[model samples]
Target: MDRKTELKEKRKKIVAGLEETYQKLVEYKRYKKSPLIIAKNGEVLEIAPEEILPTTPYITNS
Candidate 1:
């Protein structure tokens, strides 16, 4: 394989690994029933899944 192709393949593998790790984190958090926390302006905030707003609008047919 060419160097460019090799680099692309390596990047793909790294991305896949990151995705797998993220999934595991999600499962661990769910099992522990812990909310995601972040710090902003020297204040800590907890965010649960339900607290997140949807990006897409809901559509309904009359």
Candidate 2:
């Protein structure tokens, strides 16, 4: 593969890993009944677990 192609593949893997990690984090927070804190538009917000929505669909291995 060309260097550019290799870099692209690496980036894809990184993004996928980050997405999976984020899903797990959301689940953990929900399980712990903790809030999801985020910063947007120079404002900090604490979203309740019940209000937090996963950015990706939940995947299960069966």
Candidate 3:
């Protein structure tokens, strides 16, 4: 095994992941309000609010 080989393998994996994400986004119409939502901060537990909530709410990062 060599350094170049390892790098090529890593790059391949990254490209595969990016492709998968792109496909998911393209086929996202079936999934409305995706259950697999990402919460990058605190107070993100409650989703699907009926009314308007303040944007830029106080949410601490993990």
The CA-based lDDT of model 2 is what?
0.86
Give the alpha carbon lDDT tens digit for every residue of 1-62 in model 1.
99989987887777677667766766666667778687989999987844533232334341
Ten-residue region with minimum lDDT total, candidate 1: 53-62
Q: In candidate 1, residue 42 scores what lDDT?
A: 100
Q: Is candidate 2 or candidate 3 better by lDDT?
A: 2
Better of 1 and 2 by TM-score: 2
TM-score of 1: 0.63
Q: Which lDDT values do the candidates have, in the order given? A: 0.66, 0.86, 0.51
Judging by TM-score against the true structure, name the best candidate: 2
Error at 58, model 1, angstroms: 24
lDDT of 2 by residue, 1-62 (tens): 99989987897787789888988999999999999999999999999998888876535342
* Residue-level lDDT for 49 in candidate 2: 91
Looking at candidate 3, the ten consecutive residues that score lowest on lDDT are 49-58
RMSD of each: 9.6, 6.6, 9.4
Of the two candidates 1 and 3, the one with more favorable TM-score, higher being better, is 1
**Best first by TM-score, ranked:** 2, 1, 3
- Runs off by more than 4 Å, candidate 2: 56-62
In model 1, what are the clashing residue pairs, if there are any? none
